[model samples]
Target: MAIENRNICSLYDDEKENLLLLHSAELLENISQSKEKYRKIIQAGMAQWVKGLQEGRIKLDTVADLKLLIELDIQLQKDEEI
Candidate 1:
């Protein structure tokens, strides 16, 4: 009976490990997708900001939020290095 119980525990452990691996893969995929999504969105925002600034639609000193977005873009680049 003890041997049978040990085998069952071992089976459960293998299953757990396999599930963990699968979930890890899924998590990495989601992270990659999110990074790409943010990269595109940020790039588009920066382009629009440049266009607005050039067209006299935006005052650089009044848009602190855009500065925050620029910081986020910098952070994203740092993350890619890791």
Candidate 2:
């Protein structure tokens, strides 16, 4: 009976580890897809900003705001690295 209990516990532990690994893999995949989507969105926004700049629709203040946003992003990346 004791041997049977030990085997059951071991089986449960193995299943738990497998579940954790599966969950991690799925989470990583979702994050990767989200990052790609965000990248495309950012690119599209930048292109629009450039177009507005060339057509004299976007103002200098708007450019300054964009610079601030880039600086914030850089700061955030540095924070994450730390």
Candidate 3:
């Protein structure tokens, strides 16, 4: 028996990726509003972001969030060493 591998890159084109981009933009817009009133909405957006990454709804390739997370992790490690 032979096993086949399918790459996610081949699954989504520029159009589908644009929808994900739009969703992310909307989330950011919601985040920028008054947190006092939109607290739950902001938190829900963040929760969904994490959930999407874990569940493979969002792909990490060339993504800024992943890069920022890595940089923050490095900064935390450095702070811990001080």
Candidate 4:
């Protein structure tokens, strides 16, 4: 005589559906929490932008984007006597 044993570890169809719903709720909650965090980050960034503008450290309209800023800074640094 021989004895065989097997173990199954799978969610049934209904259980899988319930898990999906729970996962979706968790994701939504995460996004909702992150929204406020993103808003604070944006606010801080805007303040920095305004300060840069006041100091004439950042010229926005003339330069298209960050690439120009980086290039110009590099050139200025290279022009130093050092």
Cand. 3 Cα-lDDT: 0.62
For all candidates, the clash counts are: 0, 0, 0, 0
The sequence of per-residue lDDT tens digits that candidate 4 reaches over residues 1-82 is 8754332236577777888899999987786566556555555655666687789998877344444445544554454423
Give the residue spans of candidate 3 off by over 4 A.
1-34, 61-82
TM-score of 2: 0.66
Candidate with the greatest TM-score versus the true structure: 1
Clashes of 2: 0
- lDDT on C-alpha atoms for all candidate structures: 0.83, 0.69, 0.62, 0.62
* Top of the candidates by lDDT: 1
lDDT of 1 by residue, 18-78 (tens): 8789999999889878988998899899888888899999987857767877998899888
- TM-score, each model? 0.74, 0.66, 0.32, 0.48
What is the lDDT for 26 in model 3? Answer: 93
Which candidate model has the greater lDDT, 1 or 3?
A: 1
Candidate 2 lDDT, tens digit per residue, 6-76? 45356677787987899999987787676566556656666777888889999877887567546654554
lDDT score at residue 15, model 2, on the 0-100 scale: 84
